[model samples]
Target: MDDLNLGKKLQMYRTSRSMSIRELSDATGITASMLSQIEHEQVNPSINSLNNIAKALGVPLYCFFQEEIIKEPVVRHDSRKTIGRPENAEEVYYELLTPDTNGTIEFCMMVIPPHSNSFDSVHCHTGEEVAYFLGDGDHIGITIEGRTLHLKRDDSVRIAPFSNHVWHNDTDQTARVIFAITPPSF
Candidate 1:
């Protein structure tokens, strides 16, 4: 399972959520030294412990194993739905697929300009999100997810939250996307 890489992933997600070791300690009741050790691969976290960290981070415990995550690019346009155009650097946009504010899942489209940031607010609630990005050469990172998900054209990712998540563009071009979430968040 590549303990070192998994530890790094866990650390990344934890820090991305703006969570400090002490804060995580408070939330998950783990120690700062232990969390630090886990990050450095000095100690292996048990599955139950990993699950606790995952729960505290608001992410699935299994996301640490996703490999072969490819990158994609953009070229054309189609109406899958949620065609929202948030002003930013990526020149990109997206559509939401569900009622995140009404039920359990909030769906929306995201259009990001290159080097743009995707977000509405540091909103919080129950459930999680899975974003299928359609922007090629667009760099998208959800802080709550820890690592950045770079897409080529059809890359997708799922995110849970331990803190407020922000989507950022790393490329200096336009990007587009579709975001879906469980549990309503308006």
Candidate 2:
């Protein structure tokens, strides 16, 4: 990975969110001096530190590795960024419909396998999200703030910022959904 580019992207995201270095440090549990050094490209951040930074910035860890800003507007289907594979606790797969996390809104297509959950535990982020379920004759259950809601085909639900939520597929059929979030959180 190019340390200079990573540092620049980090600074850009942080400033876009109007977050100071100290605030980022507090959020990621990293030291302010270390964050500053990383931002300045004085030192390369470790994987753990990078993960914490990505979580604090509300962007995917891969966003830091994206080499350049997308000059083209369209993200081809074959080239769409995919994440959250078998290595993760949940086997849910996510394909980025948008080019990158540089924009105000982020869009993704999520595929949840049968009898699996979107997350291993309750997930909460700092942005408002809307999920639209797709596919015919299939459904999934979403639990938000301790209340479980069933969603069928073409159903859409809005989740408020920081509300704990999770998506679960109990049926034998795999579930697919399109998600849009402001200030992207992967």
Candidate 3:
């Protein structure tokens, strides 16, 4: 994470979302002056403040720390960055396949271990998501808005925006999927 560049990235994301500083402040419950100071690199926001800002921006908290801005169009597999997850997150893992969020869509690779779930609770975000199962069989189950759908290899699903969704691997092998989200809300 580049501490000095955080403010610039914040400003970029805020402007890309068409949100004014005042609007962000109102949404995050932070003072407008403080937000301005953060954007100007005059102050360092605490983790709590950053979490609030991430929630307001509809992105993962790790998005702020990603330093690769994707100057070129290609993203190599070996160079792909992985988002940090909790230490206890042994069931699921995520690898960011997209080099940057400066585009309309973000891509990621999700791996769910056997008999494990992606999340403990169903979650929803601001943008639409499409998931493509890459496993060999219908071992992946995705629950969206209380309906569970079994997905096999080459199967894809388009999830509505803000729909509660969670995935699980019920088989004895790992389940893999390629997930894409519009507006880069991941």
lDDT of 2 by residue, 1-186 (tens): 342277888999999999999999999999999999888877766545676789899887657755355768999988776654423534677778987777778898988878987776787878899999996337889999999999988999999999999989998887889999987765
Error of 2 at 21 (Å): 22
Over the full model, what C-alpha lDDT does candidate 2 score relative to the true structure? 0.80
Compute the lDDT of residue 147 as modeled in candidate 3: 99
| Model 3, span 36-147: residue lDDT tens | 9988877766545776888899877657756555566788987665543323345466677876666778898887777877776687777899999997546689999999
**Reference-based TM-score of each model:** 0.42, 0.66, 0.65
Q: Candidate 3, 74: how far from true, in Å? A: 1.3
Which residue pairs overlap in candidate 2's backbone? none
Q: Which parts of model 2 are misplaced by more than 4 Å? A: 1-67, 86-90
Model 3 local distance difference test score: 0.78
Q: Give the range where candidate 3 is weakest over 10 consecutive residues by summed lDDT.
A: 82-91
What candidate 1 gets wrong by more than 4 Å, as runs, is 1-95, 98-103, 120-125, 145-149, 161-163
- Predict model 1's lDDT versus the native: 0.59
**Backbone collisions counted per model:** 42, 0, 0
Cα miss at 89, model 1 (Å)?
7.9
